[model samples]
Target: MKNSIAILLCVSIFFIQCKEADSNSKKPTVYTVGDSTVKNGQGDGAAGLWGWGDFINQFLDTTKVKVKNHALGGTSSRTYIQKGLWKPVLDSLKKGDYVLLQFGHNDDGPINDDFRARGTIKGIGSESEEIDNMLTGKHEVVHTYGWYLSKIIKEAKSKGAIPVVMSPIPRNKWEGKKVPRNNDSYGLWAKQVAAREHVTFIDLNEQMAQKMETLGEDKIYGNLFYKKDHTHTSAKGAVLAASIITQELKKTNNSLKDFVLENPTIILPKKTNIYLIGDSTVANNGIPEAVGWGVELHKYLDTTRVNIINKARGGRSSRTFYNEKLWQAVYDTLQKGDFVLMQFGHNDGGHIDQPKYRGSIQGISDSTMVVTKNDSIKETVHTYGWYMATFINQAKEKGAIPIVFSHIPRNEWKGNSVERADKTYGLWAKQIAQKNNAAFIDLNDSISVAYEKIGAKKIKQFFPKDHTHTNADGASFNASIVVICLKADKSLGLRDLVLSQKEIDRLSQIALNTSIENKK
Candidate 1:
């Protein structure tokens, strides 16, 4: 009897300890998978496009949830999982986690055996696969794109994670000057599969197409794409994509409905803090009418939900930014989930006359060159590449999302044709961003588009005779461009920062009235 009582007591103690351990454990995470539209990439300049995932961080209650981005550039649903890219996610997934999948940008590759091919015509090929070591260099079997996606869904579900399928956001491409319906494209197919599998779905492509139509083609350009390029999004374009997804989530899932940041919150500040660390164009100049994009950026933001901290200094290159410890001030104060905007190059041209002051080394590539401070002596300066990249990597190390923008345009560009960075510091900035896996905003491309639409006569009002800097009007104009870029790119994490239609109309009216009063 004594032995039986002792054994029973020990079993009860073990059960209680197990329950305690389980209760204290952290919850599983949510992950995303997609292509270039959703993937993070460098913007045209150092200060532009905003990614959707960046803003998604704002919507979730961080205490109980975690989000991971597994999206990449130039990938389709077929290649994303095939290249072992999905392995890391699969390995890390735990029960009760979630996977959000979006694709379709590059899935329409040639039907033949091209290296980039991802999908074939519907019902054109056999469903089964056979081992063929001769045809494939490595793998013995090749599965259809649908098959691969199904595998991901099955695997995720098997691990007790919910798989939510979202169609790719539509490109800015138009037919007859109107945004086309996504009736037959991959966007349509994504819906069909979601329905067939009874998985949750978000039709981002449909939403984006309708959004562009609602905004109008002329109004959509700079806000969506930097140029006539219909495929990729400008910084604003990314934000728009993210907003559609975010709003859709509120509609799609009841559990997440209350968590939307747009809903009034009595609990805490519940705002996302953004810190800017860059050269003149993205930093606050504080000079009237001579504001940089960073300085004028406040007009587009909802201050109640976001805190903007600008630490940009003029005449500072990447090297000077660090040497002066300007970034340290921002870094020391940043909280987790905060964002950092980085732009440089107007001064990083490596001018060596101020030899003691330049940031990057000279004579590395056309992208990075040594500039002599004075014509008399050829004193080598730092490479713009080296100094700029260091700032980006450091910001990432600090656990902040680092968004780099291409340098804004100069008066040197004469026409609607975009002045490619060529061998200049701007080109180097773009290359360095891509190499580092940092989010990039093509400010150069975005600004040029705005300039073209406003026309050279109207542009003179914004840009001074020198063409490099802008007046207050120009600064505000540029700020609008940055906001538009944030809306379309979906990479800078500004999706949750969108203003509703009523809010947008109100701001636009306020701006118009302010302009009219100034004219008077």
Candidate 2:
């Protein structure tokens, strides 16, 4: 964690020292021009939608070339030429600079309407349409979509600037899971214009559509585009589109290829991520005998509504998990309204001052202890309750709902009932949760009831290896109980994500093989 912070600080200091020198000697600029899909609503990510032009810079090595977005919302190919949005960009182009052109989103609107008369003629021919522009109240001659694009390419070349033409990105509309392409109309015309002008042309429409279809429609619809919006994209969608453009640009022999960053980052559509963090009791590594409740929990969740990310590993207590920065990884990705379900305590009973070094102190208090390892590195440790409180509080600071789950009950039994943790780890977890005002799921208590029904003799099958872990059938049973508890808690607002009782019962039985597991 300290190393990451130190690297960021060094980068910040370098930028501060070189700010004036960079301003005095600006690098070559790559200017992008188009409509809303290229640069939406002031290019500030308003309404959770942005354009590819706004994110293209993240894929460029800014030390070699800078980027400028000259695209405007609600402008078509003909209107961009008519409204003088392209003039300033053309005037500023230098000998070695590059200007990208991608228009056509709004070119299909009514040409002579009073609302926004921005449409152009249908084809690439020299056809012209004379209209008394209803919006501007002036005589105007509109050209074809191809003609408007050709003018930009030719004019940009006349000023000694390289021009690259691109087809507009595809909309969220789909036909039987296949993205509908614009190859027949605007794409064909844009390609023809670029060929005639002898400039580089990128078919972003077709290319991006292929990627979208492969990524699946479920991951795209609500995540990339706002619900009910076919056009425009969320910030995540913009990043995906920009990544496609950067990939295509570097493939060309153009000078801009030298400016593209090596191994540019590709961002997928953003969704609400629900992370499950804990020990091996919550993880599955293809071990049939050691399946976890977190693995079987996927059977009951509405995957389309939220992403279930299981970050749980084996043999990690709350203290060791935070100390190793495993919790930091999940904390970095938490967005407002996301959820974090944390479970620990499987390994918290290990030795703290010894070589194993996984245990925390006993109770829920702001207490600390210092220990030295065999390598002579000194570390400060806290109580199990303090670590639990830290997890709950940090999650709240990130605006994520933190759910405290007392670790699942083991197979050990005392006489008639399964062994309980109320006197130990379970009590501490509950106290920390109450103090933090967080939701607590007493897996140790609720799961024990089911175990007690089956009795210790019949439950031995779940723990073939030891008394700690459960088999696949037992994991499914525990997961069903967890779902029921989640649905009853209305404060979490996750009732709609749980499966119906009928489905839950079917999955919990694990094909009716675990009849003895949750039998009435």
Candidate 3:
């Protein structure tokens, strides 16, 4: 009786281990498989060319969802399988994952070449070609592009992973004021395969071709593609392709659409420059956990319309910024149509002329105090308001729009209410802004309101080390709030540079949902 009981116990333990291992392999990941158009050389911007896979993560909430790009530079649908590349991809696919397949660029090449026999039989037909591939040195039966696509889809489905078929992004080929589509060829065939397999199909080719034509030849040549290379895309073109894919996915109602960044960055017609000048809270660079809002704010704006240049430095007050020539660098780059966003006071409240010599006089007065530094250099200091006024006047003289922002609130709280800089630096920032007739963004009060709503206990994760700097999540929250505020004030004339109010509202709701999940 004891020997029989031992055998049964061992069997039960083995089953439990198998179940645990199976559950561990079930984490959802998005795998991209294609040619150079999907992922260029080494998946790096080596020669200014990037694949759509390189920039897809920028449009998705990648911190929550993982994206793996397994595309090679010169492989077709036929070679990808014949060369055993697809086997590893199949091994990685499990239940609750997605595999995006995009090819057709190299599929138009020679079939039995001694160099690269990467071509596939055309169309979604059941045609097949038997050839000893020169590249792989193996006997192979190559089928139509649709046949290869179907094989990948069916195999991914067998692993319980969803397969998403994508038509190749259109090359920079134009047929008199309009780009031609691959409607009768790869695009149609890819769509047919997805329909046959009953999976989602994203028409990336049509979407990208239309966008390219709309951009005009001038913008498309130098800005997007590098003129000579029409087959592969530059970094900008790749990002544009990825953005269009996500936008199409939004319409398709795919589950992966949920991971897409709301109002993802895309190239637009008009262009402007947005210069940001502030302190560590605005320019935090290296600390992996801590991120500055300025660095992430561009994700909220359309890159094609305005380029955000974050010139803010860590541990610099407005007084020191001008003194250190950091502000001058941005001022020189300022153009007539550019916008300047200045946020200070986080480091401006430090001791004046002492340990750091970074703080300024309290108010918006023209008060000046002269002091001698340790290097025997005589330095002239001005009021916090005076420095703010100087920056505003300088920006205006250069035909640039200057928008003043009060420093963001720290994590400190008083009985569930977060600390607001409204009485001090916030008040001065607004006073200077109003005095110069500049647009004012009350970042201190705005961030404090959000923090209070989120509550102190829940946001402890935002401040890992101290009360001043914010982690990536916290910076993203602040940037979203800034976008919301930017949309609210039309006098800033940033309507085209930032997102719409409806988009920010949706983003705010997403943040709330994410917070709720994190708490759970």
Candidate 4:
């Protein structure tokens, strides 16, 4: 007994010393800059759409360094710095910290007097002077896009931060059924600036487009597009994008290169308590071999960080999600920074004459009323707004960041068009998010965009022939969509968990291997 105790104590001390030594080693800090495409939640509602920025987190070891994403919606090179978002970061920059800058989408906005005008001409001294007088609303000077980008590089370098430039990701627009190049546009411009500045450049646009070509349009839709939008990637697509960035980074930064894993990072631990609370799309008891988005979420998250305790019972509205103590059960176990994603509204559509499941009657209302059930208790079905808001509000009350998803889409995708939301659950959810200032994900719009690009025939592979519920591929595909939305939402702080290409491949391979192994 004495010998055993002494041996264990010695081993423990050795590990403790090693951990201390490891902690002392300096890790590099990564700061991000970009427009809405790289920002969080810009493409939330699209089916599988997500910004690559969100998935970048997974590639880094959090123990070594912190990754801060300051990207926001509607920001272009000209606006990001002018809005003062870049100043605080520049001021806080420390030696050896890295700044990864991406822009282009919003930078393409026309140079109008409107707030949405983010576009400026490309090149080093390119300038189009526009002046709006006072009362013309926020009179400001708009610089050329390249000039603004150059400013960011100059400022970041002054602060002793290493600047790495990446081109904006390519949109889904195709020339003769093939994705085009940024050679004549933003991609070329970004490269030109990087060359002039002596900064490292990652051609994300070229890399993504090339990979998409290799994957082929068919595979690209399966791996990338959330619902229909070709420009953005699904969770799977983001993972793939992150992987490409990692591989490119590895060619130079050897330290980060080895951290790549062979799995997509969704490995689950047995008895992990994951609680799924959503509408029919995320609930249990959907069609056989057909599960909700939540059902497949466990496949991407690390099991060590989770417990697969699914509480997603079917046929429950957002009101019922909490009334039945579903959120309460998950809330009880939540630790600091734990996530509770609330998706609903497949069944909360306009109900004819039925008080229950009806949208907010009397104009976006959330007034609470009482009803007595046969059980002799007063029950209430809160307005769709009230139900969703309450769930998010309560989750936040429990110290959890409530991620609000604006309902997964129905299978009404055609070529470049989706069945418009038509003032049902999708609209109501958006209102709930805005009212509470909650982190809302627009899955509906993102998916609709995707539907338009992929068209009706290709979408059939993802949404199922029955037009409801997804297959394993479909479920995994939809789950990727959710990840993409969360990644872009910036509010979710999920950028640190994004996976690299090798890591994604590893994760995908592992998932495939695990499935194969299970089959055997």
Predicted structure with the largest TM-score when compared to the true one = 2
Candidate 3 lDDT, tens digit per residue, 1-520?
9999999999999999998766555547889999999898997565456799888878887656678899998999988987789999999777888898898888888888799888889999999989888877888888999999999999999998888899998888788898888889999999999999999999999888888888887788656775447888877888888888888888976788888889665533346788999998889678945678997786577564468889999898999999999989988888897889999998888988896899899999988899888888888899999999999999999999999999998888889898788889999999999999999989898888887877888777676658988766677778898988888886766764565566666665565556456556
Q: TM-score each candidate.
A: 0.47, 0.52, 0.51, 0.49
Tens-place lDDT per residue, model 2, 407-448, is 999998889888999988888888899999999989899989
Compare the candidates by lDDT and give the number of the best one.
2
Ten residues in sequence with the least summed lDDT for candidate 2: 511-520
lDDT, candidate 4, 1-520, per-residue tens: 9999999999999999998876654666777778655654653423334566666767766566667777876778877886798898898787777788998887776666544656676655667676662323667777777788888998888887789888888775566657898877888888899888988888988887887777666556435652235465556666666777767877765344444444435311122233557765775565745667777766565332355556666667666666778767777887655667777776665441355543333224867656655566666656778777777787678676666777777776544577756477777777887888777778877766755664666556555446666556555556666666655655566643433234443544444344344444
Q: Write the per-residue lDDT of candidate 1 for residues 438-508, one digit (tens) a residue.
A: 87778877878767765665566555536677656666666776667777777666854654435444554
Q: lDDT per prediction?
A: 0.67, 0.85, 0.84, 0.67
Task: Let me know the TM-score candidate 2 reaches against the reference structure.
Answer: 0.52
lDDT of 1 at 336: 68
For model 3, where is the 10-residue window of minimal lDDT? 263-272
- For candidate 1, what is the TM-score? 0.47
Supply the global lDDT for candidate 3: 0.84
